[model samples]
Target: MLAVLVSLLPLVRVLPGCHCQSTNATAAITATTVTSVVSGSLTSKVGGYAVFDCPVPLEYVTRRSRPLVIRWTKNGHTVFTLSGGSLTTDERYEGRTSIVEPPEFSDAIATSINVSSLRESDTGDYECFATHKNRDLQLTASSQRPPLPSSQPLSHQSSTASTLSAVGTDIVDAGVRIKLDVQGGDIMSIPPINQTRLEHESVHFSCVKEDLESTVQWYKDGVPLDDLPILNGRFNVSLEGSLDIYDAGLNDNGFYLCRIMSAKGTFSAGAFLNVQYKAKIVYSPAEVFLAFGKPGTLDCHFHSNPPLTKIRWEKDGFLFDTYNVPGVYHKLNGSLYFNRVGKEHSGKYTCTPFNDLGTEGPSTPMDLIVQHPPKLIVVPKVLYFRKLGDNITMPCEAENVDNKSPAIVWQKADGKSLFDPRVTVAGGNLTLTGVKSEDRGVYRCVASNIAATISAETELIVEESLFHQKNFGLHINSTKKNIVAYWKRPYSFCTVWSRDTSLKLSNWNATATSSDGKAILWNLNASKEYEIMVSCREEISGESLFSKSILIHPKVAESDQLSLQELNKSTGPVTDSFDIRVERSGGNYNVSWTFTDNSRKDQADVERYQVKWYDAFDGKELGTASTEANKRHIGR
Candidate 1:
């Protein structure tokens, strides 16, 4: 267990992102070979088998038939296999496991084993202990990744080796590849998942008939459970289709079937069982690419039969903490978390899991890559000023690319391309050589990369410079259901800019115009954010330019009526409360007051209300505190 924790430290750094709620891409199928302890686990469904292939060649340790004496152990070296001479086996794994028979070599027999009739308790690290030339040798068969053969030769080995308990041997690191052959089941009567329990714990499996009065039968590994001598007749031998082993032992683990004969038909459904000591890591993501700047959880899922006692997390190698780094920490739910992701958060990550029922073993490690989104380092101004025939440029810059520069595009507010000869768009900037009245429109720069996309808006007003500041302003706001836009009579025209927020490109930047003074732009697209700007002009053509610019934004109403501010006007202070007096007490210059708080009367002991101590000269607060009604006077 200590060896696993030491190997997993120094995995990852810092990150800033959401809790991995949203995803912009599908998982790219990663074809990785089985190499490390993390990727060498052999996974097989319940009641199946898994194979472990050692990296040592058949010729490495072959000395006829009795070349090397070998044993297999799990969870800190509790012997699962004691194959010294007469093929001895642990009680928990009896009759279901065996040394591979082939190659006609003695060392080949000890190098590999087939773990068959698997139950949930079999989910853990498995290591081999052997006696070669009187020198103790150890090789581990463990991984958490999908089984794939290693590209390296048989002599290939990983430099990193994990330490097992009761060390008295020379450890040899080897990769193990595991393949799981899964078979589906019917949904008629869902059977319980495979069970793993300690000695004397209860075990149950039942498959009832469509007709309660029908006959039923129970079988364990094709044999009647009642004949199990290890149970010592502690099990119920009735033919009622319910099998219970409350006082279970290691020999009781095997395939259990509850067969029922009903009017519909005769069918069988059941679960498997195995004896285990404590808990073990069952599942977790081998890799995760969380969005940068968004909060995310590094998943490290695990399971235990007797209920887990605790879990410890380690990242990029030291114990994970929020001390030096503020937002990163370990969670009790078997996952590391971050309030946000930063660039320094790129690296490998791992989890050290173990089960401490009567023994302990280290867990597999995982590596995940987090992708970061691009950022707009420089954005265009919200409004731009220009004169006739004068050149104009809107510089838009972006940074934080995912290994490459972000793609930049320039377009009008109405989703039309600005590819005219007068308009030159290079990268994120737009340059207009000769400004005209027609160019007086809203434009934006869009920058995007694999991680995310961002944009900024800027409006060019060439015709506005021809007109003087009229000193008049227009106010705008929205109600719950309507976009009420109105102005005085001299306002010759009003323009409404809207876009369907539901990603419908056909309705992008839809506009509405009215000429009869009061432009009540109502019944808008329910999903639109209307940018209603009203401009006035004396005449439609012949140098009678439109009034400067009256841009107003319609906001979602937070209350009865949402009053928007007119950016063109200067106003005084807006307040809804009154000031108080600070009394001069007998030349000591103390202040006191008695104020009543009629509101929130239901909440007692809450009043000394708005009393404050002010300097009276500078009109700034000097001291402040609430006075309790129980005591009226305060001593100096």
Candidate 2:
């Protein structure tokens, strides 16, 4: 039993181990003793695969058959093959990777393939083998991964860490120590050398350090910024050891540094600045062109730090208003709105954005122009004739307004306002309701806005009723001669007359002369009733007037009658006789004669005679003429 127990103990310990191997015998037998082999020992950081320089040729052995078939692989994948002294590279490595030498090279007897830039995956075992008759003859070698080359050193690597003892001191030297033996020990990054920034723009600085959690102190020039009263709203400091300049300007631009209150030591970055201010304009002159009595709006945007506490706008050196503008006097989130604008708004405007920091941004100025007042336009200037009691409407139009407030007002020539409370002025237009004859004169429209006011006037002609004449008259007379007569108008100086079938007579004349007096009509006819017309103009509206017609038939008589008689001596016993007779025929007269002699007293004594007559109308007579007594010798 003692022997069996001792044997069982040995058996138990070795039995478990041997049993485990027996179960995995096939895997163990197939395992490879692929120890790492190195060639081309000098390593480089770039290449697609590991390379090796064979010390000897694979076909050096005397055995012939396949001579020598060498297989090259990386990470268990075949990369190339060598048959005798010939080499065949894999397709993947055709162009991107290549061998420096052919397989048969005598020099070094070997060469390596150069892949492109190396990758981490390229790190793996690389094996080469010699085969005879397609069977492995011997394992040539394996190349272990080469060590990667180190990075290039920084250009200023030799220089020590730079430092600045003063909080705001700039132009610091390298390899300096910070000691509080004298006073405050703080540092700030310097502004970049000769750096230029637009005026009213922002500038930022960061105090970089390996220990980002360390506290950093910032300074401008040589003063401690945290102690200065000039730290209005224009400057700011960040918790991440950074400084911000909301609006950096020429005065704000200087040496700056950031010093860390590190447990070890202080470090800093030095910078210099050259702040530049560009010329700017606050308003757009082209879009703000305004007409006389018209309104305008000008834009003003400027650079400001901490944003502008206030933006004061001015016109022609006069106070305009303070504004909160969006993307103009302030950032895009600002606010500014304009009310009614006018001609007074035209001119140069100044926009200044500032805070207590002594005004850091540009003050822009823009120009404005006032244009001509709007013209009044009326539609259907001559409306249809309205009856005495009819109602009408007249619209006055005026446009191009910079401001649409307060509206427009309408007024008539008669001093009475039109439309009154019922009138409405919208969009530069005036509407009139219940217009009457008195509204027929010239009407004036006035446009007013915050900036300016303007007015336009137009005439509204109104026709009178046909049956509304003030006076009507007629005259008749008896005559012995043709009468020349016309109606002597009364002293009613403001009147007109017409004489035609249509009430709208082309011959109608306003007998009331202008300031320069002259007869409105000249010629007249007699015996027949002469038609005359008159009209009375409205006192307020020259367009409103009444018309009247009248007929005048004046009496005229023949004052003097002349007779002509002639005798011939040679023809004795011959006598010529003429008779002068005056009779009334519609206001004119006619004369006739007959001559008788011993030759033919029975023939009724026919002869020729000459007669003349004078008019009693104006005391004038016509010329004399001869005619046969049979024609009655009619004359006047």
Top-lDDT structure, candidate number: 1
Q: Tell me each candidate's TM-score.
A: 0.28, 0.23
The regions of model 2 sitting more than 4 angstroms off are 1-348, 351-367, 376-385, 389-410, 414-442, 445-499, 503-513, 517-636
On a 0 to 100 scale, what is the lDDT of residue 363 in model 2? 50
Q: Indicate the worst ten consecutive residues by lDDT in candidate 1.
A: 10-19
lDDT of each: 0.48, 0.41
For model 1, residues 1-636, the per-residue Cα lDDT tens digits are: 112211211111001110111122111112132112222233223333443434332334344635465655566555444343345667776655555543432233444455444444555655555556665544422232122222211100111211111111223543222222222222123223356678778876544333556667777778776676666567763344466777876567676776666666665555677776555555655666667888877776665545556565656775554456778876766567778877666666655555567323434556556677668888886556577898998999888555678888887875566878998877768899998878876787888764567788777767445344342244444543334455555555544444334444422231445564433333353224543444443343212223333333444454422232331122211111111222324434333332234322323534444334333223356655555542223234
**Quality of model 2 by C-alpha lDDT:** 0.41
Kindly list the per-residue Cα lDDT of model 2 for residues 520-610, writing each as its tens digit: 2222223234455443344444443343445555443233222111233222222132222333354344444334334444334335444
